[model samples]
Target chain A: MTTTDLAQSPAIPRDGDGPVFREPWEAAAFAMAVRLHERGLFTWKEWAATLSEEIAAAQDRGDPDHGDTYYRHWLAALERLVAAKGAVGPAEMTARRDAWDRAVRATPHGQPILLANDPRSCAHRP
Target chain B: MGAHHDHDHDHEERWSEVELRVKALESLLTEKGLVDPAALEVLIQTYETKVGPRNGAQVVARAWSDPAYKARLLEDATAAIAELGFTGRQGEDMVVVENTEAVHNLVVCTLCSCYPWPVLGLPPAWYKAAPYRARAVREPRAVLAEFGVAVPEEREVRVWDSTAELRYLVLPQRPPGTEGLDEGALAELVTRDSMIGVGEPLPPAGAAA
Candidate 1:
């Protein structure tokens, strides 16, 4: 493929000749959904249904729904499907979320937030 | 808050809360053995490197150069596109709409962002926005104008609404000066927006070489 022509336009996100993530988290969210579907966790149809439901829910919650949070809805749908398939429970997800929030706060800016950065994990490290 | 501290890290660059949430969820899933980071890496890499609008550009370019291929594309887009090796999920059903002097075609998905992914890659942000979805069909001339396309008063604009089962790709009218250009050079002129009918292909300038 020709890289020069594709790189000239800023409308689409291109990292080199391929599509680039506008943010790292968008890539993460996208991959998680596709991977889960690949593992037969849920059909693409089910995933689409869950995603539309999430988008509708967000619209009800006063989201502008102008597509800025498209991946946010995607992440929400993946979480919902993963939970529904008995892969993970709501409680575990919440606990992990809190742990991550803690880890995120503990890590210095520009550094990767490692799970070990969670102070609770550090506390348990005898 | 204005006190200068001797820290090496810049305070302004921090992960968004959503980013933290994704990392946390990934960590949780990985710990449970539900997902492997390596597998996720491969998936992301595939989309990043292997799939994108360049695929669509090639299809448009071939159609522009070969009348037989254009006939095949217009007749059976799915099979024609697959002949060029661009086929996968979300692109099983395909429709190629052509733009002529008297007719222009535009595409949108009113319900959600249903796009021809195997060819076009991911739909752009605006394509998924509520306003575009709602307005592209209702007032396509106005929408096209916003994208810097001013269709003449006599030409008719048709809108194709893509769905989960079917997707549309616009065959933009080739510019006048591109007759001498080869297929590869022609592909260079086919932008992502042109195939979506929001804009026209790049005019042959330095591309004729």
Candidate 2:
């Protein structure tokens, strides 16, 4: 705690003493991590380690840590921990991610994007 | 069976890659039964609405108005905060440090953002960033200056590094001219930054108006 890292710290996005969520995804990512933790998927200790590792990796890769990508690292950590526990495979995650991308594109304006909206998921449905 | 629209890119075109990834992860987790969307919603609702600085504010107010409660808070923060109904994850262990005329206390997580979520909600973005984490312990006075706090030369600054096992909440010095204020009014003066030791509570002048 005494050692000085001297890296950049971002200003908090404050809405009168309340933490701000710039996007719905940010809140969702945060909630997902907490929910997973509550479900006993990974200890908070493990999650903290994974997140610290992710930030360190990004810092090594020249991420300024400007604060916006904090949750990106958070999501990455969650995914890594979840995958490491064998709860979800990387390949399946990639496949599901693609399905979601297609589903988002398929969903009409102001409509909820469902997995069924993805043509691939629909075609693969038994 | 599909309803095709050539102009359907609008929904995701505005979305960032990380955003899509979050949605994808949530959907995938839900499908696998590893996540319950409703449960996720409840957690989000709790953080957004139920838990936050107000909880810590109430504790600070009570501590300010009541010596016995403050004694319990400083001695056993975990049970004391739970006594006020703020016991949960990220707050299983608690330490309440007092700020006095001679000593000012500041908290940061040098390893990561380990905060008392039950009391203060989420850690602010800056609290989690590398700069604050690295600098707070090293150059606390300068950091406090950045947060618009100026610690006099006579006062000592003590920095607390929070961890997953333990978290801290600073019980800021109760403001002067507030002896007559009730707990609720006193709570209103307890800002989140004050409890983090970055800023002081609202002065009575502001609270009066």
Candidate 3:
């Protein structure tokens, strides 16, 4: 098969005009979703549908819908979809989120943000 | 940058609310079996190594050398960029505005962080910070000043605010006395900040050295 065909068996995301990220994390999120889709974790259609739902829910909850913090919704949908797939428990996800919050709290500025070992141990880092 | 940075001393509190949340998700995903770290690294490396500011630099460098491509870039940036194989999410649509003797262009995403991904991989920290989001649209000249970009009195400064569907990348004017520099060297002079219009390209070799 042609390289382009293999690349597009799952169509690659096309960036709109301008730069793709306002922040580094947006690229990280964007990359994560693409990687997950490439692994057949979820189809792009599934991702789009779930993301639209998440955006709608946010708007319902008074998200100005200006596209500010849109990736927040993207992350939420990702979390929900991964949870739904049973790859990881939702409660476990929340606990990890807390761990990250704590990690950030403890990390001095300019140092790398690393999760504490306890949860990493519990979660089975490998 | 100096005054504001000094004012905000509790640097540990710097991770924005969204950054913290996203990091947590990444951590959880890696810690769990939901996502593969190696696959994630492939994606990250794709952007870091294969696609990013270098690609943007190549585009700018080509435009500097080829006027026809530059015209196409401005007229249909998306199509032109795709011709160079720089196409994907965050770069699905693009507008390449030129910085000329009479005009200077600056890019911002006041609403959210919308940028051209195929060219500039990820926006730097300051580009995504609250201060830039709040200040860019209100006072374009002052923001440029903070970045050390001086648009002379005769030239007008225009700020392009990006959204989900559209993004803008500034094509900085080629530096003077570089008629001898080849395209590769020209691309080397194209910095990420210059493409974003926050700063200018480096001086020519003799002048630079």
Candidate 4:
């Protein structure tokens, strides 16, 4: 999916007041939260409650790295809210993830390879 | 998705060949008992989740939103990035390149994927392998073209060769039409590939509406 689609989707709070991410996508999620709140899509209180539930579920699953655990929960929460809001559908997102997974599996070491030079592909130019 | 299935098949074939070579090496090392499977698993997890992409993201975001910060980034990327609270092993030294209209920068550690993990979270899969490193420097424009990134012939493309000691990340220019955006909002526009200079920060969909 396009970055725009990802951005317009609802904010997914990472579990609790856990460690803020050091990466851009994590920051993007945070930014979305702020934007969503400003627009009144959801209040900070609702966000907190949803996130707490997510963290609790992760704890039940016996995941370690409490803070990191929350982050994943936060991503999940956002994915759910965004899908509910119709910014994007779960099926489409799953398809994208599946495509990425396929690419990873096909690579020699189960890694993803950058394909920037296929002659028949219009996306590839010199 | 089916439209790309044929291309995917080709990728799968190439990947299988490469995987075999890597598995062979890993198997040899495992047989020698040089690397414990459990320890290897932990190491991979630590690097992927904790060290790599997270670090890279902070650096790219700062460069996008802060002019003075960007200057500091290019001047002393390692220390500047560390200021965001990410540092230590695998990070080492880092160089930040600014992408401008007259010039564009792309980084590839052709020898191997020697990236600044403290700044960028994890090196994307394609980055750590051979084809990208070998081809990026030699035919960067061609490589970027595949990512749907176009560069004018007039603009000079400067490809940085990464080394074990020094790692590089691109600081793509902030997209137009995002005036008056807060730092956080601007940061949202920055993506992994944009930070690598292979793509532009996409415009916010709401902005058009």
Candidate models: Cα lDDT each: 0.81, 0.84, 0.74, 0.58
Q: Over the stretch B26-48, how does candidate 1's per-residue lDDT look in tens digits?
A: 98888888789999988888887
- Per-residue lDDT over B24-142 for candidate 2, one digit per residue giving the tens place of the 0 to 100 score: 78887887887888888888888888889999999999999999999999999999999998999999989999999999999998877889999999878788777788778878987
Over 4 Å off, model 2: A1-19, A108-111, A123-126, B1-15, B206-209
Off by more than 4 A, model 4: A1-126, B1-42, B52-54
Provide per-model DockQ scores: 0.29, 0.49, 0.15, 0.02
Candidate 1 residue A42 C-alpha distance from true site, Å:
2.2
Candidate 2: C-alpha RMSD to true structure equals: 3.5
The full ranking of all candidates by TM-score, starting with the best, is 2, 1, 3, 4
Kindly report the docking quality category of candidate 2. medium
Say which candidate scores most in lDDT.
2
Candidate 3 segments exceeding 4 Å error: A1-30, A36-92, A95-126, B1-35
Q: Residues A9-120, candidate 4: write the lDDT tens digits.
A: 3321122113334443444443344344445666544555565555556556764322333345655665556556655456755544444344455444344353212222
Q: Estimate each model's TM-score.
A: 0.81, 0.89, 0.62, 0.50
RMSD (CA, Å), each prediction: 7.8, 3.5, 14.0, 23.0
Show pairs that collide, candidate 1: none
Top-down DockQ ranking: 2, 1, 3, 4
Ranking by lDDT: 2, 1, 3, 4
Worst 10 residues of 4 chain A by lDDT: A10-19
Chain A TM-score, each candidate: 0.76, 0.79, 0.71, 0.55
Please tell me what DockQ candidate 1 reaches: 0.29
For candidate 1, the per-residue lDDT at A18 reads 35
| Ten-residue stretch with the least lDDT total in model 2 chain A | A1-10
Per-residue lDDT of model 1, residues A13-68, tens digit only = 11223335677789989988877777788877787778878877888898877767
